[model samples]
Structure formats: structure tokens, C-alpha cells
Target: MDIILTSLINLIVFVLGAAIGSFLNVVIYRIPAGLSLLYPPSRCPHCLTRLSPFENFPVFGWLWLRGRCKHCQAPISIRYPLVEAATGLLFLVVLWNTANPVEMIGYWALLSWLVALAFIDLDTLTLPNSLTQSGLVVGLGFQIARGWDNGLNPATVSHALMGGIIGAVLGLWLLDIIAFVGSIALGQTAMGAGDSKLAALMGAWLGWKYLLLAGFIACFLGAFVGGGAIALGWLQRRQPMPFGPFLALAAGLTALWGETILNAYFNLFFPTW
Candidate 1:
């Protein structure tokens, strides 16, 4: 019975996450387009027909409508349903990992913000300073609050804060150097401001050690995936590709497995910390 109840709760959380994902889709699409996310409501991009409540039911609606606008039968972007499903899966993972309601909420909030950042960067190739800056502020405040609640020493708190700042600055500066060198070598911009902002945000959340780990993981994943695509003849040589999604993925993985990874590395190398 307890197991069944837990499963049921997770199912509900998934559903709720999908609902929030639907709204996030609006934000992702509209914000970059310089349109109000809430003013005119969701409409068919082709025909501009307003979507009714039933017509906006996340993945189900897209499936039922056959991936077309209800009024004009125009094809809709597949991103909508994909985002909703992805968000639902992310929420399910968070729910599985956390039993504390407050902690769950914090994780959910972080996940939502990350999702928004990921899509926005994918579309615009620029992370809005607004979102990244706000995330840094909020994440630090939350960390401080957690530290205080746990009765951590002020020295520890100070160390974490300094580490976060140093990590963020280092990540951003390293990316800047890479972009400069890549531009000189390739004659085009290799990384965008968005990528730098994202690295900074990750540093703010995970501190210097995890930031380094995330960067290494992102680079490895991007190289593997990009190489696979090239070998498959899907991406041409010298063709530009978005790197934000891969970075976001790396950050997400780090969030879940950073402690384990750090512990393993320390055990193997230093063993005394």
C-alpha cells in the first residue's frame, strides 16, 4: 500500500509538471519573440486562432490535434510536446530523489529555471542577463539559508560564497578566452554570451569543484555527440551547432551525481579529505 501510494504521488507530480511545462513552452517561445507570454494567450502561429482550454492540454492536445493547428491545420512545432514531456520526466526524477516537500519545491524551481534557460539559449543563442543574474542571486540566498538552518559555521558559509564567486568568474573568463581564440583560429565566434552566462549560473549553484566537473562532462558529451552526428553525415564540417543544451544536460547530471563523483575521485586520489 505504501509503495502504491508513493507511485500514485509521483504520477500526480508528473502530471503537474507537464502542466507547468505547457506554460514554460509559452515563455520559451514568446519571450525571445518579444511578445507577452500571457496577454493574448496561446494561439495558432499560422492562423492566429486562440487555443481553447482543451486544445492546450500539453502533450495530449498535440497528439489529438495531429501536430497541427486546430483551426487551420497548419503544422505545429514539435518542441511543445517535447518540452512538456521532458519537464514531466525531470519532475519525476526530482520527486523520486526528494521526500521533503520544501526540498522538492526548491529542486522544482531550479529545474524550471534551467529548462527556461536551456530553451531560451537554444532559440536565441543568448542567455538573458536577467535570468542568469537572478538565478545567481537566488541560489546564493538559498544556500545561505540552508547553511544557517543546518548550523554551519560562518567560516564554512564564507568559503562557499567565495568559492561560488570565484568559480563563476573563472568559468566565464575561461569561456571568453576560448571564444577569442576560436574566433581567431576559425574566423567566427565559437561560443556566445549565453554559454558564458550558463557556466556562471552553474558555478553559482554547484561551486568551483562541480563547475569544473560540469565543464569537463559537457565538453566530453558535446564532442561525442557532435562527432557522431558528423560521422553520420548529419552535420557538415564547420557547421555551427548549439552547445547550450549539452551544457544544460551536463549541469543537470552534475546536480544529481556531483557528490558521488566527487567522493569517488577523492577516494581514488586524496582519500584523506
Candidate 2:
């Protein structure tokens, strides 16, 4: 009975995540175009036909429609359903890992932001300030609220605020410095302010220690994936690639397993400690 109940709850959470992901698809499409998220009801981009409720259902809707619009028969991007499915799975993983309700909420929000930012950056090579800036504020606010939930003591409150601030500064300065040095080396803009903002958001959520881990992980992923793409002739040697996706992936991993990874590193290198 307990196992059944747990399974049922997980299913419900996955469905909820899929629904939110559907909305995120809307945000990804509209935000970069400077459209109001609420004003325009979701419509087929090709035909501008407003979708029926059944047609708007998450992953099932794409399957039902056979990956094409009902009215115009225009093919829909598989990414829509893919995003929904990925979000559902991610929600399950996060749910399994986080026991506290508040922490779960924070993790969900962080992942959601990362997903949207990742896709947007991939599509446009620009990360919207609206998402990153708002995310930074939300992260700080979340930490402060978490501190309050734990206790109203000054130590807790100060620590929460200090940690968040330090994390944000660390992320911002680190990225800014990298961008500065890279620009001098390459004689072109190597990174954007948007990337810095996204890093700051990561720091605000994960704290400085985890943020450093995330940065290292992102650098490693960027090199590995970027090199693979170049070797495959999919990307040019000089082509500028978006780094937000790697950063988002690293932040997500750090949020989920930073402590484990940190301990493993110490165990491997400083076993006595």
C-alpha cells in the first residue's frame, strides 16, 4: 500500500511538471520575441491557429496530433514534447532527492529557470535579462525565506543573506573576469552579460562552494562537447557556441550532487581529512 501510494504521488508530480513544461514552452517561444506571455494564447506558430484544449495536452497531445498541426498540417517541432517529457523526468528525480517541501520548491524553480534559459540561449544565442535577473532576485528571496523558516535568529538571517550575496558576487566576478581575459586573447567578445547573470542566479541558489563546482563542471562540459562538435564538422573552430546550456546543466548537477562530488574529491585527494 505504501509503495502504491508513493508511485501514485510520483505520477501526479510528473504530470504537474509536464503541465508546467508546456507553459515553459510558451515562455521560450514568446519571451525572446518580446511578446507578452499572458496576452497571446498559445497558437500554432505557422498557422496562428489557437489550439484546442485536447491539442494542448502535454506529451500526449503531440503524439495524438502525429507531430503536425490539425488545421494547417504544419509539422510541429519535436522539442515541444521533448521538453515536457524531460521536465517530467527531472521533476521525479528532484522529488526523490529532496525531502523538504521548501527545498523541493526551490529546486523545481531553479530547474525550470535553467531549462528556459538553456533553450532560449540555444535558439537566439542570447539569454534574456528578464529571466536571469528575476531568477537572481527570486533565489535570494528564497534563501531569506528559508532562513526565516528555520529560525528568526540573527545568525541564521545574516548567514542566509551573506551567503546569497557572496555567491552572486562570486559568480558575477568570476564570469566577468573570464570574459575579460578571453576578449583580450581572442580580440572579440568572448562572453556576454547574460551568461554572467545566469551564473549569478546559480550562485544565489547553490551558494559559493557549489557555484565553484558548477563552474568547473561547465568548463569541462563546454570543452568536451564543443570539441566533439568541431571534430564532427558540426561546428567551425571559430564559431561561437552558446555556453548557457552547459552552465545550466552544470548548475542542475551541482544542485543535485555537489555535496557528494565534493566529498568524493576530498576523499580521493585528501583522504586523511
- What does each candidate score in C-alpha RMSD? 2.7, 1.1
Q: What's the TM-score of each model vs. the native?
A: 0.86, 0.97
Task: List candidate 2 segments past 4 Å from native.
Answer: none
Worst 10-residue lDDT window, candidate 1 = 142-151
Q: What is the lDDT for 181 in model 2?
A: 96
Over the stretch 1-273, how does candidate 1's per-residue lDDT look in tens digits? 999998898888888899989998987887777888779988898898999988899789999999988799899988999999999999999887776665567667667878988888778776777778887776666556555555668976777678778777877876777678978998888888778877887787777788889888888898898899999999986887777787788888787778888789889999888
TM-score of 2: 0.97
Residue 8 displacement in candidate 1 (angstroms): 2.4
Would you give me the overall lDDT of model 1? 0.81
Candidate 2 overall Cα lDDT vs. reference? Answer: 0.93
lDDT of each: 0.81, 0.93
Question: Which segments of model 1 are wrong by more than 4 Å?
Answer: 99-103, 152-160, 185-187, 264-273
